[model samples]
Target: MADGVPMVATLAAKTMEVPGVHTLSLALDTHSPFDFDYGQFNMLYLFGAGEVAISIMGWHQGLLQHTIRAVGRVTRPLVALEVGQQLGLRGPFGRGWPLAQLRGRDLVFITAGLGCAPVVAAIHHAVANRDQYGRIVILQGVKHHADLLWQTQYRRWQALGECQVLLAASEEHRHRHHWRLGLVTELLALAEFDADHCAVMMCGPEIMMLAALKQLARLKVADEAVYMSLERNFQCGRGLCGHCQLGPYFVCKDGPVFHYPQVKPWLGREGV
Candidate 1:
């Protein structure tokens, strides 16, 4: 089921430094503009080094922006690419933000470290469909004040009055800039909202999500109300590759977004 399309996209523009990460915007030739929800991810292919999943930060004029953190070989070149460069890509794949289903519910979104990418899409989607939901709370954890991404856009989202955001740093000693220091979970304990009325969403480091999930259980949040994404090495663009399989589930097809119960049992299992 791997999507072996072997297609390529043109780099439309590249930005130097985007708040918390580096960004590259690409314009791909397609028959139609693909549809995607906020929390979904696309499988990005690099011919030599292989593939990685990245979220669409924003899109316009047939372009999709991916704000990436330089971590491995494939992404290292991604950060160095100039305008007019060609890049291999295939998909607007994986599950996205639960926009429609979240209607009428107050929402809480939490993220830490590199997890901000996928969550941003959900935030953008919700703000666009503000009439469907109630209050929104955004909680973030980072290493330092400078580590927070998209300050300008984030400030604009905050201005909508539908969202309240915070940044928690792991370090104790701090900066003059306004933000909390510690963990994203700490913000949860301070909030007195009812879990029954809110849907919980998160994107971040494995440990961060693990800690966040543990805390949510204490909050009495229902299993169905909690959600997180999955990531794995994919050899084929389509589901046929089997490299990204988790038992019967294919991260490429079944999900990159799974309800807690679906993946909780496979946490330490091989092929997960």
Candidate 2:
């Protein structure tokens, strides 16, 4: 697909219970394949409502899926979309998780809330090549139990012997079973990955990532071995638009995924 061309894709399925969040399965209206690496996002447009960037969740069979939460003018209409509707897609853009470099090493994924959507593909990739990694650990956090997005899928991931999944919620809910009630960083405290041998990939609110980094620091994880997906205001997927600029980089072109050290200098700084 070209950079700016809008490919019309049909909404093949929908899954949701919350008022504003949606998990949509979209298939190319032309019946073509939508291939993308884990961590990349697509620009989705709804005819009159404009577009928004959405992370590529996992694909089921041949349909591409995205977990979208209504947060803006464009997304509000997007979440309200029904099956059989058509929308415009312009990506599979940006860099992805360093899955290739992570082979044979322990893998740790730390995500909060909707952040799980971006890493779902990476989890599947690890499972498909299960022997390539030492141990696979996933730590997820949400505000409340009702905020959890793929409840059953976590079990499927845990079924893989090499993988371990732990969940936490900042605000406790009554239905809690095995879920720990506290900050996500609390799970990090109990995690047992060798900092030197593991590659850590984290995403979520900037604060959550910062908190996780602090905990990882106590564990002695090297700055180079840690990575994060940075979210910025990206207008154009290419570097042309300065909306996604961060210091000397354009998040859309240079990142979305970056090594922790590369962004450390600007972490808490105001207005890069």
Candidate 3:
């Protein structure tokens, strides 16, 4: 893959796990080789349909892996794509969770299901440079045990920081757990969150992040210290398209990740 062309490969791998859901792991090579900030997303093109925003969950060699759960038109084709199917890709875009800037301060992460991908990236960067940050914690929630991706990686990350998680459905297995068993927000009640200099990040549905924001405020954390990954259409990774627009900001440009205080006024309204 040349640095000037998109790798645009066929579906490198796909699988249906007992999470009972069909998930696809795509490996794409891009001409513009780039390093992605933890939580940045890329625009993926599925011929004959449209495009979808996907986060890079893992990357190795020249291949960047995206773990996708089949949901809509773009994703459906992605799920149906065979090992040799081709597709278009651009980005590694969006402002990622800014844990790097908050280095030396306490940090907390709350995510749900696939939302954990970005959170994992932040953790990967943070832990690798642990001396630059303070205490770290993670709380992840998914529909079921199987919906949880990267268990081994999570375990590895857990070894580096204070990690915890929740699973809505626990019917399939049993393990000695430090894992909580409810909504991700519930963990807020148990944490002694430091609002003074600590940063809290939440990524999931808007409602989930909103709830986390409210609780962080109650703990005296300023809105500036609270961040979220807004889930929007994100049709254009370059920010020219308006699908993920929010007033003066473009989620693709301004952020998929933003501090709550920076975006509070624009949440419910429309028109960018």
Give the winner by TM-score: 2
lDDT of 2 by residue, 14-98 (tens): 9884657898999886666677889999999998988888999877888989999989889989988889999999888999998
Instruction: Please report the TM-score between candidate 3 and the true structure.
Output: 0.84
Candidate 1 local lDDT, 1-272, one digit each (tens): 22557457788888766442688888876656756677666667766766777877777667788888877877877777788988777776777666678788878888887788888778777778888888888887877766777768767766677577666888752563436777888888765456898888888777788888889999889888888876678655357768888877887677777877888888655545
lDDT (Cα, tens digit) per residue for candidate 3, span 1-272: 23223447656666664343344555555365557788888777877888878877656555667767777777877777877778887677778887658987878888876777667668777677878877777777666666677777667765654443333323342353646566667777776446687888778877777777777767788877788888777656657778777777888788888878778998766453
Worst 10 residues of 2 by lDDT: 172-181
Ranking of predictions according to lDDT? 2, 1, 3
Task: Give each model a TM-score.
Answer: 0.89, 0.95, 0.84
lDDT of 1 at 58: 73
Residue 33, model 3, lDDT: 52
| Residue 131 error, candidate 1, Å | 1.6
Pairs that collide in candidate 2 are: none
